[model samples]
Target: MKKNGNREEFNREKLLKGIVRSAEKRPVSMDAITNLVDRVENKLRSLGENEVSSQQIGEYVMEDLVNLDEIAYIRFASVYRQFKDMSVFYKELKEIMEKDKKKNQDQDHSGDK
Candidate 1:
């Protein structure tokens, strides 16, 4: 895996540890995490490349977490993004809230049809 222009061996255990840590105190299940890891591996394999970037893997993890559990997503994002201040955290929360609100609105509109 290439992280910040440095090539290194892909470490699945390290990836799992980060995921597990983020899910601590959250309701995300171990099975869910396993499935997510499997999916990420499949994606990487499908790309037909031996080298992948940490950012790419991080994006995949974030995508999975966002769909699986909001709290877990935030937890993972905080560490992945290295949030520096409350403002950054607040902004991330706001983006999630807005997206949720929009989704709810779309559902409401659909129900009216």
Candidate 2:
């Protein structure tokens, strides 16, 4: 079992629940979610620590979801980051857009003959 900063036993079920909720109405499959959970568990083991922060776990989830589904990634991020207001939400969305834009630009430049 993992422990959070608060020194409480981390609930793995809660992690799965959050992923499930984020994937709701999205194209993410149950198999993918299961695989993600396994990956996160492996990550925790790889850390070889007695306790791990919720923030760290959330980061791993966000990284996995970002590649699995953008919508699900945003959904999980909004909740995990606990956005205080629309401004925060907007900022996150803008950052994601900018990252995608830059990635596309780099790809386009690389493809140029």
Candidate 3:
């Protein structure tokens, strides 16, 4: 359900449109986006719930986008999250940077083995 408590059927195209908008001019391919959407849709179906909040859906997309493309992730997040100001954007970018740093460190450590 949406924030307004109204219920509607899920539209795959609608979801695709949102993701496509974020992926514009990015390296992410249509196949990847379609697969991501498939995964999200499959996940929601697996929930076995009659209804799920729109917020939850958005969160799921954000999770997937972050792994797909950073630029696309930020683009989608700015809209899905409705970023208020530069501070919010800064915080999110910082988190991504921190995680990336940690990931690189882990890879470096693993290579030492």
Models 1 onward score TM values of 0.88, 0.84, 0.95
Off by over 4 Å in 2: 1-5
TM-score of 2: 0.84
Best model per lDDT: 3
In Å, residue 19's CA in model 1 sits off its true spot by 0.9
Residue runs of model 3 more than 4 Å from their true location after superposition: none
> Better model by TM-score, 2 or 3?
3
Go through the candidates in order and give each one's C-alpha lDDT.
Answer: 0.89, 0.87, 0.93
Model 1 clash count equals 0
Query: Residue-wise lDDT of candidate 1 within 22-49, one digit each (tens)?
Result: 8888888899998999998888889998
Alpha-carbon deviation at 63 in model 3, angstroms: 1.0
Each model's backbone clash number = 0, 0, 0
lDDT of 2 by residue, 42-72 (tens): 9999999988888889999998888788899
Clash-forming residue pairs, model 3: none
lDDT of 3: 0.93
| Ordered list by lDDT, greatest first | 3, 1, 2
Cα lDDT for residue 67, model 3?
97
The residue-by-residue lDDT of candidate 3 on 29-88, one tens digit each, is 999999999989998999999998888898888899899999999999999888899999
